[model samples]
Each structure stands twice: as C-alpha cells, then as structure tokens.
Target chain A: MARVHDMGGLPNQGRIVMDKDEHPFHADWEARMWGMNEAMWGPDSWTLDWWRYVRELIQRDDYLTRPYFDQWMQVYAAMMVDSGVATVAEIASGKSDGSRPKGAVLMHAADVAKAAATTRDFRRPADQKPAFTPGDKVHTKTLGEGFHTRLPSYLMNKTGIVHAHRGNHLLPDAGAKGAEVAQHLYTITFAGADLWPGEGRDKDRFNADLWESYLERA
Target chain B: MSSSYDPKKITEIHEHLHSELPSDPALRVKALESLLVEKGMVDSAAIDAWVDLYAEEIGPKRGARVVAKSWTDPTFRARLLADGTAAISEFGYQGHATGHIVAVENTPGVHNLVVCTLCSCYPFALLGMSPGWYKSQEYRARAVRDPRGVLKEFGVSVGDEVEVRVWDSTAELRYLVVPERPAGTEGLSEDQLAALVTRNSMIGTDRVLKKAG
Candidate 1:
C-alpha cells in the first residue's frame, strides 16, 4: 500500500487513538503551548519549519494538561502570532484594526437572523437540483489536480450511485474560497466490500456529501 | 505510516490550509474559532457569524439503512460491490470517491474499521457527522493496535479466527465498514437489520447481533 504517511503501520502513530501522548495537553507543556495537535495536524502538510524552530527554544518538557480542541486553538493563535501573519499582541488584543487580524467566532443558531446582519453574509441562494437524481449513476471527476473542491481525494473519478440530492452547497476548497465556490453539495454512497473486498463487510456501505459540481453520472 | 513531515513541513502545510481561505479571514477565523469555543476549545469569541455559507450536511439514521438493504438485497449488494456510489443512491443516499475508495466488510469471521490517518476524514452522507471518538487518536491507535481489544471496549468481540482490517481515510475519499447482522435479528425486516447495525459496528468497535445474557 502506498502509505499516506505511515499508512497502516503503528496504530499509535497512524490509527486514531486517544492515549497519553496523543493527548494534546500530555505532551511537553512547551509543546502544548506551542500548539501541536500532533496527530490531528501533521507536519507533512504544513511547513512546520517555522513553528518547529520557535517551539524548540522552550526547554521545558511537553505538558499534559488539556484536550485536543484546546491545543488546536493554541496552535492557531501561535501561527498567526509566530508568522507575523498575526502578532501575539494581536492574538491578545483579539482585533485586527491596524496590525492584527480579528479572530472569528462560532455560535449555535439555526436561523440566519441569529447571524447579525452586520456580519458579512456570503450565503447566496446556491441551491440547484442535481443534474443526476437519486438512482442516477454518477462518476466523480478527476480532471487534473489543481485545488478545486472539498470532496475527499479518495473518491475522485470513482463511479457510484447517487445516494442523495441535497440542495445547493459551497465547495470548501482552497481555490473555491470566497464567492467563487460552487454553491450546493451532494451526498454519495458506496459499499464496503467494493472498496476493500477482503476488509469490507458484505452487508455495509458508505456515502459522502458532495456539491453538484463534484459529479458526472457514470 | 508516520508522516515524512518534519516540523517545517507541518507548519508550511497548515499555513497553506489557512491561507487557502477565501472568505473574509477576519470573519472566517472568528467563526471557526467561535465553534472551537462553543466546543470548549479555547476562550475567544471576538467575532460572530461564523457558520459556513454552504454547510456540509450528511444523512442521519441512513448509513445503517443502506447497510441493512444490502444485507437483504443480493442484487443491490452486487451493485454496491461493483459500484458503491451508485448503489448507495439507489436507496437515496449519495457517495463520492476518487482515485480509489475502498470498502471493508464487517462480518462474523472478519471485522473492518475506517479512520483518517491524515485528519478527520469521514463519509458524512450515510453516517452523518463522525463521532468524536472516530476523530480521536484513541480510536485510530486502538483500531490498528488491538482492534479486538478496542472492540471489546466498544462492546464487540470477534472470534480469534476472525480477521480485522482498518482503513486510513484520506482527502481523496472517505471509508466506511459494513457490520454483520445480530443473531436474534434473523427474519427481521431489512429496516430492522439496518436498525441493529450501529455506527460502532460499521467502525468495528462492536459487531452486530449480541443479546444481553
């Protein structure tokens, strides 16, 4: 198998586990403060070289004192501050007026009204009936490989049934950022044995939420 | 497989993922961070209006439904094995896979589990949101290390002769495991079969069909 990182080697490093070291707070207090989600955020994708150098300066052993999400936040702040992307002062101040970028907020509300009209609302009536309907056979497109979607890479170009047709959605992708992203998303399902015959359960299957733009019925 | 990444590479990639944001960074950051806070992430709600315009939505209570159908429908099962995405839609759920979306079957002699060694990769359509456990290092580690041991904790224990396989989900496509039916479930409707197959079963933590003594 062409292992993504370690592939399927050591479960501790590779598989998802919540144990001692895996604990965000369990690492060196310094490491924790530096914001290393360890498994959650791998150095492979991000050029940790910047964060790595700065983190090493701390001589204290990594600390084990918090949860995974907390560590993620710490890292987010650290990066903006460390890279001059945002300064430590900015993180402390929580505003970007002149020097720092303002931090974002997350809230729980079903209504758009809950969203202050003041906040920039990017949502448009992006819903569109899928070109393919339920039962329609479709194929994911693998056209080239520049950043263009939020669909998992593993599902591209593969053929499967149209499991669902959720209304319009946005593509959470690097290039698809901003008003330029495709609007709606779709959910596609697949069988277990189909992917890994030996490993899959003959009885079970899976599906995903894909934007209409992601499909091309087979 | 361990990431070939050094710290430098890791940070670089993250910065890229961060910069990839197209929304107003000020607002987007605030939104994501807000969710973090709500989830007890850190303490920062400097900004609001954080939800995504196009929120990803997956079906709830449907993953098992599809599994149940396949268990009872041989033709559908054949189609699913041949083309998972299409098969799933036949019952009204959509699936997407690229490069290679592999399916691992959960059974009496075999058990299958899925995880994103890369990040929090999951098939949202059928399974809805991935449970916190699926995203935790605890699950990833145990599933690969001692699947049997982990399953026991999840209330599932396979035979010594049974084989277990774990899938490492990727950005390319997500993976899901089909769990076998419970014993007393025989003669039950497909809907009934689907009901018995919990998300845990698909993940290989628990097998289907076990009655309390």
Candidate 2:
C-alpha cells in the first residue's frame, strides 16, 4: 500500500510517505506468530483465544500505520512496564532493566502475585443474571446538568430495550464514570436509527454491555 | 548497554512461559526478560479474557447469516423489521445479548450501513468474532463522516438514486440489516445461499448471492 505513492513518480514522494516502522508490526511477526499458534493450538488456534485478540487489535485504526515489529515491541513494552519489570525511562531510552530500576512500582512480582490471587479477575463474570429481561423498554437516565456516565458517548441519553442479559461484568464504563457500580453490568441492544440519525442503515444494528448506573426506565 | 541479541532466543523464552510451571508466578517476569532480548508484541492475558468473552453470533459472518435468513423468510423478515428481538428469538438465538434489536431491510431503493461511533459493541456469542477491521476507529469515524466515501473504499457502491441509511449500533441495541437476494438464485439451498453471503455484505459494502459475480 505504501508503494502507491512511489509509483506516482511525483516529486517529494519520499516526504509524503509514512515509514512502516513509525507505526507497529514487524514484517515477520505474522509468520512467526502463525507458526507458534499452529504448532501449539493447531489450525484453529487463531479461531480461538489468540485470534480474538488479533481481530480486536487489528480492527484498531492504528494497525495499518503501525510497523509490524513495533507492534510486538509496543506490546512487549507495555506488558513489561505494566508488570513492573521495566520503567518508562528504560522503555523510552532502550536502556536495560538488567539489575535495578527507577520509580515506584505499586506491585512487583511478589506483590502482583498476591494482588492477582486476592483481587480476582473482577471482570471475569460477564455471563451472570441480568437485572432486566428482554422486551423491557428502558429510558436512559439524564442526571441533572453535569457530566457523568458509564455509558459511552454514543449511547448516552438513548432509549433502547433489553435484548439480552450477559449477567455480570467489571463495568469499565461505570468505573470510568465514577459510579458506585456493581460489576457484571447488563448487555443491551439499541436501535440503529436511534443511535445514529441519517447514518443508520436500513438493516444495520448493534449491541453493547452496559452497567446499571448508565441506564434507567425508558 | 548496546548489545547484539539473538531474537530466536527471545522467541524460545516466550514459548517457555507456557510449558513452564508457575512455581513463582513467573509469566510476567519471563515476558519481561524475553521482551528485553527480542522485539515482539503480544496481547496480555487481559486481552485474552476479553476475546474469550467474545461470542460468534456477534461475528460478521453469522451476523450476515441472520440477515440472509431474514431475507429468505418474509414473515420472519417482517417481524425482524418490526421487532428484531422477537424475530430472532423465534429462531432460538437470544442468549447473552442485551437491549432491543432493529432489523433494517435492504431494498431496490435503499441501502443500509452499520457502525458504532462509540466503541465496538458487536454480538460475539453468535458471530464467533469480528474481523480485524470492524472494531476499527477508522470504521467508526469515517463511517459517520462520510458513509459513502468509506463504503466506496471497500468497493460498495451507492448509486446516486439509492438512499443510503446509515445505522449506528450504539451501546444500547444492535441493528442487523437484511439484504434482499439477487436474481437467479431461485432454487438454491439455504447453505448454498449462505455461501454467497460474506461478512462484508452484513456491513453494507459488498452483497450476497448476486446473479453473476
């Protein structure tokens, strides 16, 4: 795809082009990943847990622009930084976290283990009992003139019905919106026309998991 | 330290995390060290958890199936257009999903498109999983700004005479569009008919079971 501009033979083509490295993904990562997944999990390896991650991330807008190796590098960097093996400076500078590292890490190896054991993967329960049943019309609550929501910007103030009940979830939106939210929020279905006005396709539709705090009687 | 590292060893170490035991809960450390030696990226277990949560029904292919079936059955189609949830549940498919459903039917005069300007809220249970492109921010942003332009890029042409209805799947309900089948597929079996329906058809770019191509 990047070659298209070069084919134009126009001046400043180099300047106009974006290098693959500036983004994510190494050219060989796919081959290596495919091999590993195939060897370990078989042909359907991607169809299972691994592929889901790939599909979700690949759908992100940055996938095309990101370099292949860089993608792996970034993921590697994030996991390390997150798990406390490296610091931001070490990652940014390409310096080694060989011995000692800087900065305050809330949880190192031992700490992370203890936390993991005790904390629980809170969001793990998405298939629990739903507070609302299908066919129920619910109105989105408009809390008094102030900013608040576990709902995404697109779903706020929209009316929808309960199409399904996933049980429970961590309710990230509620967490983000500062709600005293219980985990395992309900998954609801909103109408396409209701969500987007002119843009709603005649046949296009969608659904999302939401917290109780973001909804009310419609 | 400027050191020459063999990426092969890093890959080896990564594979080790799985075969090895958790005597020290060392998945994180192993990941950290391997990353230091090699250049690679991987989704964390948190990502895996989300993927595990994803269901196939919400995937594009199965989503396309639902739309195609609705096209084949008028009574169901009408029910779907009127009340999508009831229509779909009649076929025994109403689990783990939430909110209402709206069925948008494609017609000679109308074309439909789906997008979630917010985040990706697809039906994972039934659809398997989404393609790498559906949850994209590009799809979300561009689908809203220029539905025609974006669809065109994907080879979906909207004639000037056709009224394009863009359906935004928000955090509330899901919308699945039923596209009318093309000519010359009269005696085809449902499975045969299904073969012609691509995931892109459900998204409103390409279509299903056309006459020739």
Candidate 3:
C-alpha cells in the first residue's frame, strides 16, 4: 500500500531534529512496547515483515499522526485482537475476561534462553541465476496498491544501475504473507538528479536494495 | 546543541494528548503487562531480559571494535569492505537482522549514510536498537532529500567538494559506514582508537572527534 509511511522526498517535512542525548525508548511505555515486540517474535509468532504489514494496516490518519512507539503500540494492540489473543473489551477494560486464545507458547521466562539463541537467516541457496548483475541498467516496475511492498513510493518506475548483487534472500512480499520465496537482491544506485533534480546535488547518489521481482531491464 | 523540540514544548504536547487517554503511558503499559501476565499470555521476565539485552549487552561498542580493528588490519578491512557479514562475524557479531551486511567506506571524496525511509530497519545485532531521532518521521522524510543539511544540523559538516551517498535501507541487507579515521592518532592502540568511534559516526550522522588530551 502507498501509505503515509512511504514519505521519502515529500516536501515541507521540516528539519531533522538533532536530539544529541535522546534515548532509544523515550518513555516506559515505549520500552514495554519494544520488549513485547521482541517477546512476541519467536519461531511460532509472526515474522517481522508480518508485523510491518500489521503496522501498515493502521488507519492512515492515525498512522501519520501517532508517535513512533505509539504506532507500535496501536498496531500491537490491534494484532492481539486480530490474532484472537485478546478482545476489544479485554484491552479497553484493562483486564482479561478469561477468554484468552490457546496454543500461543506463552513465552515463559525459561524460554528466554532458547529464544535468544535463535537466529533468522534470509539466504537460501538457489539454482536460478541472478537476472541483473553489477553495472546493469534497470528500472523498477511500477506496482499497484493493496499489498505489502518494500518498494518505496519515491523509487517506483525510476531507473537505476545495479551497483552490486547482494546474494539471494527471502522476498519480503512473500514473507509478509507467511511464505518465504528466495529472490535475487541488488543494490541499485539512482542518480540524485533523477530522484530529486533541483533539490539534491548532481554529484550525490541514492542507493536502495531491491528484490528481483521489483526490477526489470531498462 | 540544536533541538527542534524543547522540554517545555514536549510537556505541552504530552499534556494535550494526556487529556484524551485514561491513564499515563507508563501506568497503561504496566496495566497491559499485568493483564497479559494474569491470563498466562506473556512472561514479564522474558520482556525484562529482552530489554536488558539491548540496553546493556548489545550496543555500538561491538561496531566500534569492528571499525577500530579494520583501521589497524589491512586484510581485515579489505574483507570487511568486500563481505561485511563474514568479516563482522570475526568478532562474533552476526545473525538476526544481519542477513547481508554491506560496509560502505567513507573516503576522502565520498561519505555514506544509512537510513530506512519507510521504517526503522537497523542492524540490531551489531548496533543494538536505533536512536530515537533515527526513527523520527522528520528524519525519515528529510534524510534522503537533504543529507548534508541533516548532517550539518548534527554538527557534521561535509565539505562541498565531497559527495554524499545516502543508502536507503529498503531490503534485508544491513549497511554500516566505515567512517574515515581521524588523523593525529597514529600511535594510539586499537582499544584507544575504538574509543574514538561513536555510534553516530558509524551511522554516518557525525564524525569521530579527535581524542582530547
């Protein structure tokens, strides 16, 4: 979906705030949200891409206005309800009405050691040859809305040259839908003039890691 | 030295938003956790441990060590610039959000900065969690559009002669900027050099300042 979250080079975004001494989690709730997010992401739980899709499902107005962690909290609460872990009444009442879902693993304290040891690897050996190699000119295919996509709205249909072939990795689009499909990834470099002609310097360049499905020959 | 929001302004915004919610954020989070625990849905201890791991054990120190070692070891530097995942793993910092690491060097003529304009996708295993300003909407929207301008606000003044390369982290590959080592520190040990490497420098927002005598 081309939501407000994909705001890369839009105008009037104001200046980047220089918070020299800022903490990662501004408030206690933010820390709790972070911890919960980590705890919920186990082998049996939702993938990061799935969580991102849940976040993208938030109403556009709230998605745009809420603070960073607030957005996380909102999406998490919604997921809890959507996945049947909790209900609307349970969250609003600040108490569980004894209607919790089953088979969630619970993520007990004993499980922390095992969970911490788990590692996620995106690479998968494949026989398919990479479509684009280093120095290959390519253009990103314009994609339609209504699905989880890693292709940024700013770079859609834009032309770029392949800078490097980053080995095959699980496609995020498939990962979001609970399926893992290995695809070639590349670091494509776009001229600053192409992304933002007058705003950016001519010498400057922007690079993005794009999957094979999102690219085609120029 | 510069901040777009002051405490007073933040307090005002908090108060305005506070009126809409039933309780404070801290208390609300506590309540939510308690409710989840009451129903045997979550383990509070696990949450605490997870937070501690990020806050204490994993951090930019790991990244600083990698930078410092690369500065002194030519072969390691070459491997790091070539295959960052395998190179960084020499220090035992790999796996989890580190699918395909790419180390971009900051040379005399070019500078590299990393950002996930769509969301906050960072190398958590190596750098721990991201900073607050990194995930801010303002930073996400403006970093790619005007990197030098953003860097200047962070007190990082890149010269007009140099080129700025902004890496928009759109995929699973994580990027780390090997900032140019400051001069006048030829005699310093690797540990001392690592001390000079700041998290902001690796993120390409600021440079490693010279060691003060």
**Per-model root-mean-square deviation over C-alphas:** 12.5, 13.6, 7.1
Superposed Cα deviation of residue B125, candidate 2 (Å): 2.7
For residues A1-218, could you state the per-residue lDDT of candidate 3 as single tens digits? 35767878776877776666656556668888778767764334465676687666656666677667776765555556545566555665568887655655668666765665455678889779999899999999988766678999889999999999888988888776667688998999999889888874787889999999999999
Interface RMSD of each: 12.7, 15.4, 9.0
| Overall lDDT per candidate, in order of appearance | 0.46, 0.46, 0.77
DockQ of each: 0.08, 0.07, 0.30
Q: Which candidate gets the maximum TM-score versus the true structure? A: 3
- Stretches of candidate 1 off by over 4 Å are A1-65, A74-85, A98-218, B1-60, B90-92, B95-101, B184-187, B210-213
Query: Model 2, A136: alpha-carbon shift in Å?
Result: 22
Could you give the interface RMSD of candidate 1 in angstroms? 12.7
A1-218 in candidate 1: lDDT tens per residue? 22122222233343334233322223233232222221122222233322222222211221122343433444455444443444443444444435322233223333222322211222247555458778877788764432223444445667777765544433454222222344544556655455435753444444555666677757
Sorted on DockQ, highest at the top, how do the candidates line up? Answer: 3, 1, 2
> Tens digits of per-residue lDDT for model 2 on B98-170?
2355566778887777766544545433344344455444566556445666676776776766776665553
**TM-score of the candidate numbered 1?**
0.47
